[model samples]
Target chain A: MKIVVCMKPVPSSEARINIASDGRSIDPTDVEMVANPYDEYAVEEALRIKEARGEGEVIVLTVAAEAARSEIRKCLAMGVDRGVIVQDPALLGGDGIGTARVLAAVIRELEPELVLCGKLSIDVESDVVGIALAEYLDWPHVSLATKIEWPDGKMAKVQREIEGGAEIVEVSLPAVVTAEKGLNEPRYASLKGIMAAKRKPIEAVTPSVDAGQVGAAGAGVEIVAMNPPPARGGGKKFEGEIEEVVPQVVELLKSEAKIL
Target chain B: MAGRVLVFAEQRDGQCRKSVFEALGLAAQLGDEVHALLVGDAVASQAAELGAHGAQTVHTVEDERLARYWNEGYAAALAAAIDTVQPDLVLLIATVMGKDLLARVAARRNLAALTDCITLTENEGTFEAVKSMYGGKIFATIRAKRTPAIASLRPSAYPVPERQEAQPTVQALAVDLPAEQRARVVEVRKKEEGQIDVQEAEVIVSGGRGIKDPKNFEMIAGLAQVFGAAVGASRAAVDAGWIDHSHQVGQTGKTVSPKLYVAVGISGAIQHLAGMRTSQCILAINKDPDAPIFSIADYGIVGDLFKVVPALVAEVKKVQA
Candidate 1:
């Protein structure tokens, strides 16, 4: 069995974002880029499947303007067999559908039996590329899966988290599954694995220019402006006995929030 | 004449979600003919309701597999339906299912899609939307420069419109599940039976690391029960193994914007704020006066949660009674 996991680097949640003067994109020079937290779960789940089967290979794949070396290395350090980066300058600021076209092209070449990705990247948070990739490749896809069981190499059963509960689903091999946070505990790279990852080979592939092949030329969505959400205004604190304070809170709820 | 707009009606237990109604309302404004696609077992029962919300025609796809949201089946059904409707815009509620399904259909046809649109408008048949990023810290204005675009309307961003008295033409849409969908659902385990989903709750009482243990979450639940509110937790609490991931609210968890949100023992991390900042009114109860949660809270009570929670619960009970 061959398993492939898709991952991306996004702005760290803790870092303050600075939108560039272009009014369309963010300035990246001062910001810290971390592996999208959700994709870490994808990498972790792939490693677990490989360990359990004890034979198949686990590979990580990414598409970005420049090769995301650190993010790819992070997955390799966590025990992926190899890494693939489809680097192209045109991929920058591309829409999710175009990106999916390129990724689906690369994955088709690999012809993996199963593919996985994070439910959504922390930056775009579109939840588009994963599902779009599955559709572009013409495969069964499941999103936000918390638990997966491969009853047989040809079949898979997964428990996906919906609005309130779990939906148990079964799909055939050559499927795409998106990882949510509860899927598994992503392990840190051990010293030995980190040392080994330094020598791991990173393969770079250029995207095909067949119009619909890479589809970078057909970015359907364009960013028009960038701004911050209006401030909510600093709040006020209450003081007094519990009885008095409760009434005040209720009055504020009725007057301020108007929910009471 | 304006182009046709297809609104995908999302339902659970045969009832439509508020966001679905909002999508229908928005679709009515954007197009001359507003069509609703109701896909699931017994979903046709909602045809009249969809019509009341501005749908001129309702396309019903009934299947047991469609009961729970599976992408392969829904995408195929939608792609088949689109061939007949040929909509200028396909609008869906930005729920977990809606976001996933629309993207798949869009990709199938090599079309453009913008998901979770907080602000959406169509000009000369072009679709432009605004979506917040970086945990709601920044906003991006995205435009889809094509006809027949796909977009998901964010929940709580738009309001449901008044209902009409007339009924719509409800037509049956047959689904074709492809061979690739060998995945099957064995069971659907509802963890919090009879409890309202936190996403749709008007009031939310959330706990954080300060809750200490899973057993201690009982207090938080007790307060939530008093007001018939849903329970939420910060990512830290979920990471500490105190609650299920479904209860988490933050960048890694579900985003919620209830009428009133009570944050207990939570120091507002930006990631956590990203999920709940849009709540109409926030109340923070924490031991640390400097907690970031207090910054956004409309009302704050600086004290120990163990003591404050029980006291607040009792007071709420008295007021409601």
Candidate 2:
């Protein structure tokens, strides 16, 4: 079995976001970038699957700036066999679909039996690329997968989280599955794994798609502006006797908030 | 003006979900003529409800392959509907299934789609959508650059329009399923009966590390029952095994925007705040006055949650009486 894990480096959750002077994107300076938390689950699941099979390969595929190679190395350090990063200046403004197009092109060459990615990136929060890549590959996709089992090496039994519970799905091989929280606790890179990762092969290539289909020029949507969230007003805090303040808070909920 | 807008009405158990009406409401507001697309087994029966919720036309594609959500099947059905309707804009509610289906449909057609939009406005024949990004630290306004622009509205972000007596024209769309299908839903296990998902709830009562023990979640659940709210928990509570991960609200969990969000004992990490800061009204109860939750809360009470939560629940009952 060959499994590909799609990963991206996103601004850490703790980093403060600032709109760029261009007013359309975030300022990259001073931002601490890390592997998207959800993708770590994807990498972990891929490694676990390979280890279980004992005769399979695990690869990490990413489409990001050249600077994100370190993030890819972080994944390799976690026991992935190798990595691939698609680097192109044109991809800087690529929307989710554009990124999916690039990824699909690379995935076609690899022809892995399964593909995995985070359900949604914490940075863009669009939740597009994984399913879109599945579409481009013309394969079945199960999103929000909390558990997955390969029964007999040709079928995937997945437990996907839904609104109020879960659904047990059976998808054939050559499918895409997005990792959700609770899938597994991702393991940290051990000293031995880290040492092995330093020598792992990572190749950077540009996507061979139409010039009109993989960049800001090919973007179907454009971010016209970026700004801070609207600040809340009339935010009042009361500290003192709980007996006195609880009633006052209830009064406000009734009259002011109108939600009572 | 965008002439025709189409909404993919999501259905479960042969019934249209609340999000279908919410998407229709926004579609009616944004498009000159609003159409709804329903794909599932025996879904035509719900077309009337779609009509009531401002759909000028309802398109139903009935097939067993779509009885449960398989992305390829749903995307093919939606693509067929789009080919037939040729609408300027397509809308779907940002539910778990809806998000999965939208991305595939948009990608298959090579169109631009904005997911989880809080608000939308018509721009010429295209659309501009506002959505929170970077875990609610920033807001981005996105503009679609082409026709048939696809977008998914966040659940509960828009009001369901008033029902009208006028009947909408019902069109039955033919499903052109692809020959190769590799996935099928074998079984769906529903959680506790009558439990409301935090994202769909109008009111939410959330707890955090301050609640102390797993047993104390009962207090949170009790307070939630009084207001008929869903139970939510911060990451700390979930990590401590005090609550299920499904109830967690944070950067890694579900992002919600309920009508009223009551944070009890939650100190509000930035990640937790990101999941809920967009809520309409926020109330926080904590012993620490400087808890970050207070910064965004519309109202706050500094005290012990055990003392304040039960009291607040009683006061709410009294007010209702």
Candidate 3:
């Protein structure tokens, strides 16, 4: 029961986003990068599955730069067996398809029985790489999974969130599942685990990818410009007794907002 | 490059969704020929309505294997439609199903796809789009270098065109499906009827940490009921188990941009604001005058939500009556 969890470091949710002078990328200065919030659930779910089985290995895989080693180490501190970081400048800022191709190549070498990833990264919010990776590997993918169980390690029963409710899905082994929020409460790294993580092996390797087929060069989509959304103006506050203010709000809703 | 566009007109339970028409409306503007592809068990009859909405050609892939959305089967169907239509652009409404299918098909063909775009424009057969990043904190205008680039337009971002009498050629596309599906849906559990999805609602009334108790959501629901709007909750309320995640609106939950969004007791964390700052009109009702929610709100009421919500509901009912 080998499981691989895919995670990425993204700008923290609380960080203010400022477009760089290039007008195509965010300003990275003064921004804290952390594991994508959803990826924490992916890591936690993998750990739970491994603990339940009691005789298998879990690996954390990431295609990030050198700065992401700390985030990968955080996953190891939470009890993953080891980590693999694909350090390649060509892989950075590639479109989802290109990134998925790189991940699929690495996943083929590992040959894990199951692969898990967060539903989407907080930075790009594409929600494409995981599903695309599964497609590239020719495996079944269940996105937005809230619950998963594989009693016999052959067939997996997953519960995924849909628009209105839930869908119960079943896929064979060697499948990909994207963890949604509420899948599990991720555990913080203990002092002992942090000490253990430092000794755990982290294999850094550059993938054998075509130089012309990655990064911004090989990306099919080109970003033309980046800008902040228009500022929201007019903060008309009405403060008074509820009886007097309620009508005023309704009057404006009908007349000014014209939304009624 | 051909000035033809293909849109995946997503349908559920034998009826087409309004969001598909919105995609079609945008498609009509971008391409000289607009083709609608509807895939389901028996959805050919709906092609007439899609034609009325502005599709010059309606492509239907009716198969029992596609009764439910099997990603592989639907992707194959879409790929076959793309092969036959030979359009320069592909558009879909960015629903959960749409986003999923688009990724799978794009990966299969190694095509370029942009998802959840808010705006799209064309220049000499090249299509460029603007999409949000970091949950709408910044906007990026992008262009795909490949022909027949795919993009999923966010629902409610484009308008649904008015119905007109037009006849479109209905073509039946044939697709090859795998003998055995790798994944299958065993069951679907849907929420109770009359509960609108916040993404589709025109008006939304949201509650946050200030609501205090789960039962207090009834007041929020009351105001929503008065105007037949959907009820939304902030991450704080959802995290506290006050509501289901489906009703949540924030960076972690669903992002929405309805016509009118009313926040009650929500202090407007940066994440919450990221999800809703693009809304057309916003109204915030919070006890704190300095709440971040007020900064983006068009109308603010500085008072306790417990008192303001009920009175506001009563006044709305009176005004509508």
Candidate 4:
């Protein structure tokens, strides 16, 4: 079996995100960047599936700038058999649909049996990439997968998280599954894995797909601006008996906040 | 004239989710004639309630596939409706299903899509949307360049207005679904029985890594019980295996803004802050006085959660009694 994992580098969750001077975008400089947290689940799930099968190639693909080499290397160290970096300036600033187009082209070239991605990237929080990728490739897609069991070479039983509950789904192979965190415990790169990763081949190529066909450009979705959240105003705490606090809180909600 | 605003009044089991009414209230702000598209089997019965919330017309798409949330099928239906109505703005509740389907519709139609918007306004013929970024710590305002702007509004962000009799007209549309596009949903396995969904809760009591152990969650649950709140966990608590990921509240977990949020033993990392910063009241209980959580907390108790939570829970019980 062949599996492909799509990964991206995003700012570490702990980093303080500041709006740029233009007040429409995040300040990228001086912030620590790491593999998107959810992508770690994807990489780990792919590695786990290969280990369980005892015979498979786990290929990790990333479409990022040259600066993301170190981040890609981390996936290699973790047990990915190989890597592919689709590097291009034109690919920059495209949204999920654009990213999916590039990924579909890569998947077609590789012809993998399975594809995996993080449910959503931290920066964009647009959980569209996997769904759009599946649509583009004409494959069955499941988002927020918590558990997966392969019953046969052609089909897999999967569980996906939904509002208030989860749904158990059966999807045929050659499908796409987006990994939520906790789907699997991602293993850190071991010493042996790190040394072996150095020998792993990483192919860097330009996306064969047209830039116009990818992202919001093709899908007709465009981001007009990104700004900081409004500052929370000072609030008074009512410390006393519950009788005192509950009504006070409710009063605050009705009067000042107008939320009730 | 600005096109009539469109709201996708998402329903399950024949009842409209509270977020639908909230979206309707928001739609009223955009225009006087609010058109709602409801897709489900046997959902037309709820049209009058939708009208009460300001829907002038209810476009009902009834199909068996719509009953169980067929993403591709529903996207096709919504796209077909968008083509026919040509509304200037489209609104959907940023629920799990809404988030999943809107992207596909937006992608297929090549329309600008925004998700999890907390606030919205129209200025000079352009609709601007504000979304929480970095979890909920930062807010980013976005504007779409295309007509029929598509956006998913966050739950609990907007208030559901009182019902008024508008007597909305209902229209039924037929959507042809292809067999290949329908992904089979074998079964819906709900999370552990009795566990409340944090996203739908009005009051949330969350525990963090500071709780020390899984058993400590009982105290948080006790407080939750007193306030009729849902129990939540920080990523650290979830990572530590003290609770399920469903209870996680943070940037990587669930983004929630309950009416009241109580954080116990949490250090207030920016990621965690992003999830609950929008809550109306934030109360933090931690031993460390310098915990970042206090920076945003409306009420801070610089004490051990083990000691403070039980007392808080007891006090809440006393208050409710």
lDDT of 1 by residue, A167-244 (tens): 888887789999988999999999999999999988988756456434445787777888876678658887566656
Q: Distance from true position, residue A200, model 4, in Å? A: 1.6
Off by over 4 Å in 2: none
- Model 4, A58-136: lDDT tens digits are 9999988888888888999999999998877676567777788788888898999899999888987766788888878
Top-TM-score candidate index: 3
Q: Cα lDDT of all candidates, in order?
A: 0.83, 0.89, 0.88, 0.81
Candidate 2, position B208, lDDT: 93
Quote the TM-score that chain A achieves in each candidate.
0.95, 0.96, 0.96, 0.90
DockQ, per model, reads 0.73, 0.80, 0.80, 0.46
Indicate the worst ten consecutive residues by lDDT in candidate 1 chain B: B177-186
Give the range of the ten consecutive residues with the poorest summed lDDT in model 4 chain B: B312-321
- After TM-score superposition, the amount by which residue B284's alpha carbon in candidate 1 deviates from its true location, in angstroms, is 0.5
* Estimated TM-score for each candidate: 0.96, 0.97, 0.98, 0.92
Candidate 3 accuracy as TM-score: 0.98
**Candidate 3 lDDT for residue A223:** 76
TM-score of 4: 0.92
Chain A, candidate 4, TM-score of 0.90
Better of 1 and 3 by lDDT: 3
- Per-residue error for A57 in candidate 1, Å, reads 1.2
